[model samples]
Target: MAYELTDKDLLDLATGAALLGTGGGGDPLIGRLLVEQALADGCKVRVLDPDELDDDMLVIASAMMGAPTVVLEKVPSGREAVAALRRLEDHLGRQADAVIPMECGGLNSMIPLLVAARADLPVVDGDGMGRAFPELQMETFGVYGVPASPLAIADERGHTAIVATGADNHRTEWFARALTIRMGGSAYIAEYPMTGAQVKRTAIPRTLRLALTLGRTLREAKQEHRDPFDALIDALKQTPYEHGQVLFSGKVTDVSRHVSDGFTQGHALIHGLDSTGTMRIEFRNENLLATVDDRVVAIVPDLITLLDADTATPVTTETLRYGMRVRVFGISTPPIMRTAAALDVFGPAAFGLTQPWQPLEEIAN
Candidate 1:
């Protein structure tokens, strides 16, 4: 079935995207609002199933690749994202017939909709990562040996560069990080040009539907005065790993952020309101680890979500600050991400942690 973009769909899209993000994707609000604005402006965002594409159709995955904090302070001029895609297309000497989101989490999920609307192309109903990861090379495309280089990065200041490198995925990430730092800490990137067959082989299928469903479930649960967390838990039950503990329920008491090596590294401390104790979260653009009383409760590939304790609305790591009451929840990682290939791309060492990768289920239990 064809997925039509609508305001009602944003809620599910955000929720499902967050779940898929596995703790990275930044916050979804800005992207959600941007998509809403685009739709309001009469931009039609159409979702095409992966199978609908011709084998030879050239498609590029596009998204904002930088510090989420930077995105908030320097709101996009609204042209750089699509411009980046176009620049890549120009460099590649091929017109992109469709656009796919690199992932479905938070900002990434909604970004393709906006890009597609502006570029007048169909947004694929799938993504490279069913969820989100921090680096440019963490997508399923990378896992499948798709190079992230020979890509495009465009800034709001009208500066654009077509970055081509011979490095592997991790090295490509390092290069992009350096460039993003020089570009004032954030830029729009378009990479991983692939055919439909390649997409089908590497990308996570039906992620768009999952987003829509998660969003819709959250909305309906709210309208009916049901527990949104429970609803989210139910939706994610079919995925790998077990549901973890509710780490904390409190307001953000502190946030520390700095841009280094082209990534935003930060920590957020939340003081509990209910019985849940104080929780500290460390992030690199996207939330990476959550600890309560110095005990690791959640890690990447598993999800660590911040929601308004009362309203159950998501709060971005960038926007999290003093006195914002939030309920912290956790979910397990997908099987694909738990694999050795996936870990090499996003494991503990990949994020600078010396400890080994441990699924949240084990830690929580």
Candidate 2:
């Protein structure tokens, strides 16, 4: 069933999206505010089921690209996505029947809501990546050979660029990143225009609803004096996620972070408080690897998320601070991300870790 998203649901939506972000999706704080303001200004947004679309309907996925830290500082003009969407439709010479999030984390998840609202289109309750990922081509759409071409990049200053990716999807990310860097480290993008039939086949369906359910579970767990962490695990397991485990509970001990090749690259060390061992996590704009006592606990493609041990609020990679208490969780990626081809793009080695790609389930065993 389709539902209208009112102002009251923004907080939970952002909270849940941030949890699924796995430590990188830009801040949902920013996303929530955008949606909230849009609602306050009286824009009605509706979340629609992917199945509601005609197979021939046109859809486009959109997101903001660049470091989350950068976007936090340079707030968008609020018109960037609509401008990009307009340019994209002009480039394609057809109207987009709907808008969808490129990924279901932090800013990306909510950005589509704004886009769909401004464009007067329905926001699909699905995304390319069921969770957050760093780059444009890391989505299931890219994995399934959906080209990111006729891509539209726009910024707060009204500058828009149309990029043509003829045969290579990697170049799509490279170009978008370059443009975003020049646009002062953040820009809105609209790409991967696909027919409704393609969307049904390749997209992770009902992810926004999933985020909402996860968020509601967390909130209810806390309200009823239940374990929110266990609630989170249960919510995920009941969904297509299927497997989730509490990887560690600790306090931040040390962090090594720096910007390299346009990404926030770093590692964090967490000292065990209850688990009795040190844990290490690595990232590139997103948490990619987690290790405990020199043993790999989780790697890329599978999610390594950290939450405030007490409140269960998500703690992102950029926000990891010394002395903060945290509980880490390892959840299995969707089946779309575990395939040999997907692994080749996002596995441990793709991030330069020499360790072989191992499932978190196997690692737990």
Candidate 3:
């Protein structure tokens, strides 16, 4: 089924995308406004399942790359993704058939919608990462050997740089991050141009709908005065992410944050209210590791999301603070991300942790 996004769906989409962001992916507030404005202007943006396209059709991914803080300070002009897409098409000497999100995080999840509306293309219902990851190369597309170039990165001022060659996705990330820092700490990007077959194979299918569905479930639960955590898990049960489980419920006791290597680096401590333990979460843009009093509970490639204990609102990494009552949930990544090859790129090892990869289901048990 095709879903056409209008102004009304903005809040739900943004809220749900933030939840899936797993404490990173930048805030969705600004991106939400951009998509809302585009929809209000009558720009047609429809979400299509990747399977709806032909195996040979062309599609490209679009997203914002930079410090979440910088993105907030330097709001997008909404032309960066469009500009990058056009440049990529020009390089390929062909028009794209559709647009897909590079990641299913807060800002990124909505970015392709804006680009699709502007480019007059439909946005696919799937994304590279089931959730968000801090780095460009951490996406499922990259994990499956999709090249990250010929890529384009553009700033609000209309300045753009095209990377015609990237040795690998890692090099693409390095170059893009460097250029973004020079482009005033943030820029919109169009990269990983791939075929529909590649998308269907590597992308997490129907994640856009998953995010919105989870958000709607939580919202309805709140209105009905039910346990939103139960609603969230029930929602996940109907999707590919059936491993969702609440790991801890508590109030944040401490937060430590600073910018390291142009990425938000931080850790949050949640003191359990009823569980008699503390949950510590470390992050570099996205939550990479979570532990209970120094024993590993959840690590990278497994989704670790924090939500308000009462309303179930998502608490982004940048907004987490002392004394906020929250519940933390762990959701397993899609099956594609659990392979040995995918783990090497996005596993606990990728985050420089010594622990081995453990499925969230195993940890939950």
Candidate 4:
């Protein structure tokens, strides 16, 4: 089924994207504002289900690549996103049949929508990464053998570059990262151009809907003066992520974070409210590992999100600070994302940890 987005839906979607972002993917507020402006300008965007697409349809992924900290200060002009999309379309010698998000987290989730509205094209209701990852090559599309090249990158200043040299995905990341740093540390990208059949085969399905639903669930729970965590985990039960469990509830005792190699990398220490457990979380744009009392509680490809305990708002790495009360939880990734092939691209080892990727449920048990 196809549906058009309303003004309020953007709000909920942004909120949900932030949670799904797992402390990375740029800021959701920026995405929300851009989409809000598009809607205000009377650009009606429709979201088409993957099944609605013909096998021959052309769908391209739109995203922002850079250090999350930099994007916060040097906000995009929105033109960059459109420029990236247009550049890619020109290179392909065909207008995109639909726009899709590289990841359904934070700003990436909304960029495709913004590009779709601006280009007068429909946006697909799915994404390559069901949640955000720091690097371009980590998406399921790449994991499933979709080439990342023919990628178009554009900056806030309207400067654009294309990676069409037939580089492998890792080299593609290197080229794009170099371009992003030179373009003032952040960029909008349109890449992984794929046929509808490839999308159905590789993209995680219905993640846009999940992002919207998550926002709505938390918002409605708050309105009713209910516990948003309970509401949120319950909401997860109905999605591809399945049920999530709170791993620790505590106050942030310390945070060590910095931007390294075009990525935000760091760790945080949280002391349990009951003073019994201490949670240490390590991250690279997105949370990658979590340990309590030196025992691994959660690790990469699984979702480790920090939420404001009282309000249940998702906290990104950029905003984490000492003395904040929070609840941390881990949710399973989609099965496609947990496969051995997928793990080779984004598992703990990929992030410099030796622990092998295991089912989140298995670790929880």
**Model 1 over residues 212-300: C-alpha lDDT tens digits?**
77677778889999998887778667544336446667878898977666666789998777656788898886778888888888887
What are the per-residue Cα lDDT tens digits for candidate 3 across 1-100?
7878877777888889998999888899888888888887889888898879889999999999987877878888888889999888888899999999
lDDT values for all models: 0.79, 0.86, 0.87, 0.90
Q: Against the true structure, what is each candidate's TM-score?
A: 0.91, 0.97, 0.97, 0.98
Distance (Å) between predicted and true CA of 346, model 2?
2.1
Candidate 1 global TM-score:
0.91
Model 4 worst lDDT run, 10 consecutive residues: 356-365
By summed lDDT, which 10 consecutive residues of candidate 3 come out lowest? 162-171
RMSD of each: 2.4, 1.3, 1.3, 1.0
Better of 1 and 2 by lDDT: 2
Candidate 4, position 196, lDDT: 94
Q: After superposition, how far is residue 134 of candidate 2 from its true place, in Å?
A: 1.0
Which stretches in model 4 have alpha-carbon errors above 4 Å?
none
Model 1 misplaced regions, further than 4 Å: 15-27, 238-245, 272-277
Please give the TM-score that candidate 4 achieves against the real structure. Answer: 0.98
Q: For residue 245, what is the lDDT in candidate 1? A: 45
Put down candidate 4 lDDT per residue, 107-216, tens digits, no spaces: 88888889988889999999988899998889899999899998999997778889975749999999999999898888999999999999999999999999999999
> Best lDDT goes to which candidate?
4
